[model samples]
Target chain A: MQYSNTIAILGANSEIGELIANKIAGNYPLLLVDQSEEKLYQLKQLVTEHHPKAQIELAVCSKDASWEADTIIIAANEAAEQASIASKIVEVTTCKTVIQIKKAHLDSATLHPMLPYSKFIAVDWANTTAIVEGKDENSLSITGEIVHMCGLKPLFKKSLI
Target chain B: MFEVFFSQVKDKVLLSEAEQKLVKTFFSPKKIRKRQYLLQEGNICRHLAFVEKGLLRSYNVDDKGIEHMIHFAWEGWWMADMLSFLSIEPSTYHIDAIEDSELLLISRPDFEEMLLKVPVMERYFRILFQNNIISKERRLISSISNSAEEKFIHLSATNPELIKRIPQQLVASYLGITPETLSRIKNKLNKNVPNT
Candidate 1:
């Protein structure tokens, strides 16, 4: 009942990020991070308009978001951009849950080295069920809780990464 | 530890010795070091705390990592993110001890039980809630309509002891102005004071 984790959604301007933000609004305090300040503000407005009591903050950079949040959701579509973000937030993301919205052939393993201490979980968001992939059981369970909070049923997949 | 709490309750409603003893059973005593957190943002506010000694503050951190002070709880005051405590949801505000503090904390269930067992507590809490709402409304109006100087003056007039106890930086944050601006205002006010 004591949900103490603050979640940061990187690439908050992305469609998936916005979807996740809307789903999780009012349940947890959010740090929405994006390169575009204007887009971040607009996304914040949309989220707050629907869930007026939602605790939402906007960040123009990933470092600021990752530093403050206990969990990080990487919603960036491109693998290259995700890699760049991973490198940038390496220090702050230690021992934190890093949830990636899986796309294409990108493996959570590729990001594992850069964020070695971080618990990585890849969420493949389906219509109603989310396929969650992770190596650590504890991290997987935490991710499941978060996915459940977002109104999605979590289907676990053990990852070799 | 319960002296401050008992006095505050007595101010609102009369309680017998038996009722006071029953009230004491519901609360647990705690001591928090300065800068220690009672409740952090994103955590559910499990307990409502009444200050016995020292000060605590509730604040919100923005995306830029700036803290915006929402409220301060001094001796005989209570602190909690009430919405989170009532709804059992994650809180947006962080409550922390601004000075080394002693507090009496009661969990939501215990609070309810105490009110039921000691029915007079309902009136006491209702009066507290009403006063809290009025204070919040006044703060909201001031933030919207008052100038920085006016805000500082009002705060000084209302809670001058608080201004002296807390750091000026925090005072500036509470007033929603820059520290330099607050310093300038203080200097200007001091200059206007007529010498004997």
Candidate 2:
């Protein structure tokens, strides 16, 4: 649903990641994490330029093993290895729910545009179907309902791991 | 296996003697030789089969004509394509006996009537569908993101009973990997295990 205070984006410099970040910049506290400091700064500039009132934070490289956020979105690269690492990052994060908006597991037709456009706005993400997997059924349902509130459809699936 | 199935069904659903007897009347015991087709493509899947003994597999032939195994239903398991069995359409999937087997089958209309007669069966099937969906989703995610080696580990960890019953190749197909890869992974696992 809505990340009340903090929202973290991994692989922030990537095109898709940046686009998603720009779209949600006005709604929540946006933190962009990328390995490239220059690119991170550029992303910040781009978001600020488009949505001047957007509250944005730039982390040059995410050295922290675990990040804390109410909600996290991983719009990283589509490489298998990258996906694996992103999964691990999600496992380690303190975030209650993690939304993975990657092309690897999903068809691009499901993408709801506007995350990269809205500024100083009520970014409603409800209507997105998130495939949720977790250790406990309660946790899985909780995460799914949160996404459901954001206008995102949540496909709750128990994880194999 | 029949004893277990009977106990499970009896314990889970409340059925009167008459309703239970009616349900049992449609069940025809069938013996299948190993590697024989239970239901083949282009044929109507007329029965909902319950595994009373041994193992069976339901598979689909891809465009390349390769058989991709969908599921292996062992003793005490139920296997069928819900869409095909519910509809009068010809089935695209094939189900075959993987081992010498025994099954109890019920026809479509009869089973539906039984469902109406035994209302508690709706709950039983609802839970069964939930469990089925959960397992399929797990397998789907493993196929999409996990590496071949990771998939083997994950599968072995999650479904040790399945690994014991189903052949390695079918397991590979379910994991979306080649048999050769499965063999290599198994070999690696064997070498890594401390003893035997």
Candidate 3:
């Protein structure tokens, strides 16, 4: 699927979320969504301070943010929280790219069943090279592009999920 | 349409006919009207544009909406927000056509692919980038240390065509001087010149 210019980060307050946001802030418009409004605003301030031209919007509702964004990034630390966010935005994310930043130990296939309509790509954001895995080559390549845009080398791994 | 580009490349490095054809395939030719914007300040600069004909200028808008000229691309010269293009960031400067222009544009991916496919072009880019840096350094020094009249004289000596082709107001902005000062300098210089 062709990705749009706007990207939504579900857990904008998380470390990984902020890191990814800061890296891609200049390239794409961002819709930052998180439960904590204060943390989301703080992230916006930090990103805008570094990238003065960065276009950032904050949202407390995951569904509304995901609905507006063509690409959704689930940066929630807990697998349950990621799954919960996916479930809330499932209807809005049909045929869209949903990238989940998962831990090395986490099962990559866990979110696929929840958002069957969306193209899912699991990213293991390692220190240097990020391992990107998806069911199809299209989504894998798209995810790899985004990973590269975030200043990480993407190593594509065939999904064993 | 690509004759100018091919000539510029040949001046730096010899290219085989086959390699030239390969390089040609990477760029798309575009025509822009005078005053048309090639890039806006808030947008990412996706392409590196080489001027085939006419002129283009890059400038920054201050908080008070005054424009500060940055650079100009004449025939055979290349233009882009280098920082935005390489880093995939939003551009701080806007690039616009000063005259109706024909340009050859290559996106970042194609630019990389072309370099890998035609490695000789790498030397060409190295020289181009080196010269660009040197020019920027000189401009920076000139802006900081040179007197207004000295700056005008230096610009006339280096780029006589710019003084003739561009408007007095824009030339003054590029030299970081007011248009009135530029007019005064021109009048003073013309008075000192011996009659033919």
i-RMSD per candidate, Å: 12.2, 24.1, 12.6
Q: After superposition, how far is residue B119 of candidate 1 from its true place, in Å?
A: 1.1
Task: Give per-residue lDDT, candidate 2, residue B178.
Answer: 94
Please estimate how well model 3 matches the true structure, expressed as its whole-model Cα lDDT.
0.84
What is model 3's DockQ versus the real complex?
A: 0.02
Candidate 2 wrong stretches, greater than 4 Å: A1-161, B14-19, B194-196
After the best TM-score superposition of candidate 3, give how far the Cα of residue B47 lies from its true spot, in angstroms.
Answer: 0.8
Over the stretch A46-85, how does candidate 3's per-residue lDDT look in tens digits?
Answer: 9999999998889999987876675789998888889889
Ranking by TM-score: 3, 1, 2
Tell me, per candidate, how large a share of the native contacts it keeps: 0.09, 0.00, 0.00
Report lDDT per candidate.
0.84, 0.65, 0.84
lDDT of 3 by residue, B44-128 (tens): 9988989989999999999999999988998999999999999998889999999988777777877898899999989999999
User: What is the descending DockQ order?
Assistant: 1, 3, 2
CA displacement after TM-score superposition, residue A38 of candidate 3 (Å): 59
Q: Model 2 compared with the native: what TM-score?
A: 0.51
What is candidate 2's TM-score for chain A?
0.58
Over B1-196, each residue of candidate 1 has an lDDT whose tens digit, in order, gives: 6788989889999999999867776765555568768898898898898999999999999999999999999999999999999999999998988888877777787789989999999999999999999989998999999999999999999889879988999999999999999999999999999999
Model 1 ranges off by over 4 Å: A1-161
